[model samples]
Target: MTHPARLFLDRAPSPIGELLLVTDETGLLRAVDFHDFESRLRRLLRLHYGDLALETGEAPRSTKVAFARYFAGEVNALSALAWDTGGTPFQRAVWRALTAIPPGQTVTYSELARRVERPAAIRAVGAANGANPLSLVAPCHRVIGMDGALTGYAGGIERKRWLLAHEGVVQAKPMPLAT
Candidate 1:
């Protein structure tokens, strides 16, 4: 059986960059990706949804408000927002586990694997994290390297740093002193 093929798209401006919010006809969020990462978003949707149709439109009012509140530093503004995405069972499990990570906190890939009850699937956890289509809403940016290093983010490491600093998980870099 084939899934429905209807997606709504919206461009929302944020401190980090413009974000593309994709939703279904019923207003369930499907993806939240950076503008520069549009190609990746397309690839992800294509990989999962297969020939879905996209239309430019305003995001749902609640979604817009949640994003506004989130960017305003509420941190948990999006925690309760409803979202749906396509993925395998393992990926779904990993994505569900990701939502349990509180804002301003981070976990290593290995720890995420343990949280998903697949402690031996650290690499699999990382792969699932990499495949996350919801971006900030799923909080994949909260996953870091075991050594406390900022690792790969579909939104780019600099944006990851900004998000971590925004969430108080990491201190922002000090500005240069006047010469």
Candidate 2:
């Protein structure tokens, strides 16, 4: 029998801001976005799982603990949380590549595109990165501009800076321009 689609939402305080966590019934993490952008979170959910039921419930115990640990300076704490990705093939590919970006390290949009084996799709990769449903978990904050400057982040550039600083990547090298 097919299991019913259910999403659980909960709020957790963080150093940057309050976070909105979404998890499936079996405790798989669905999305992690800022609580202030509730509409964006809902829009993402609807985009991923059309018309699914949502309920305000406690986040999974382990997920809560992981977030606590992550905020407590355990950079790898979130790496263990299982994620339930819901996006298009390209988005999924981009998100998967994001996970490979180690904490305390940053990659340019072009570099991310190269990592995903689509070197010519820098703009597309940037779009996918912006559309990431899972924020900190996928490390989308680690993607920077080719000039080693901060760029647009769904959670805000300040939060991105905070996340990178929290991960010990205060300074990043500029991507070498193509010859």
Candidate 3:
């Protein structure tokens, strides 16, 4: 028998702004900003919940604790997370490489592809980065453009800048041209 789909939401103040966290039986599916957030969130909800009841104010027991630690810079790494990924094998490989990027450090798409021994798959690596489902937990935001410019982030460019800034990346420095 298939288990019912259920979603729970909780609000937590984050460095970037107020974020709405959503979780399901599968895992933590989304963490989104509350203000000026796009309607894509509802679409995501429909796709995941599929008519299942979305019960708010019932976040997983200790999620707030984790968020507090993460925001305070006390949690340099993440563990015990339940991530649900459905992507191609190559995409999974790219996601795995992304997780290896430590806090406060960054990597370029081409660099990541090279690490996977697929230097020719830079474009493919970018595609996989775009397809990552776990967002911040997967640390996709740490991937930057080869030219040192802030590239695309599923969460939006502003949020990406905020994440980098929060991690001590100096935005005022001039970006280097891609070599």
Best by lDDT: 2
Candidate 1 to truth, TM: 0.92
Cand. 1 Cα-lDDT? 0.88
Ranking by lDDT: 2, 1, 3
Model 2 clash pairs?
none
Candidate order (TM-score): 2, 1, 3
The CA lDDT of each predicted structure is 0.88, 0.88, 0.67
lDDT of 1 by residue, 1-179 (tens): 12546888899989989989998888889989999989999999898898887789888999989998999999999998998889998998999899999998999899999999999999999999999999999899999887787788889888888888888986333333459
Q: Give the better candidate number (1 or 3) by lDDT.
A: 1
TM-score of each prediction:
0.92, 0.93, 0.72
Q: After superposition, how far is residue 113 of candidate 1 from its true place, in Å?
A: 0.1
Off by over 4 Å in 1: 171-179
Q: How many backbone clashes does candidate 3 have?
A: 0
RMSD of 1: 4.1
| Candidate 3 runs further than 4 Å off | 1-4, 26-35, 42-57, 75-77, 170-179
| lDDT per residue as tens, model 3, 1-179 | 13336666667777777766776665554443343453455555555446666567555556666666777875453545554444557876887788788777788889999988899999988987876655667778888887778887777777887777777777423444579
Model 2 shows how many backbone clashes? 0
Each candidate: RMSD: 4.1, 4.2, 4.4
lDDT agreement of model 3 with the native = 0.67
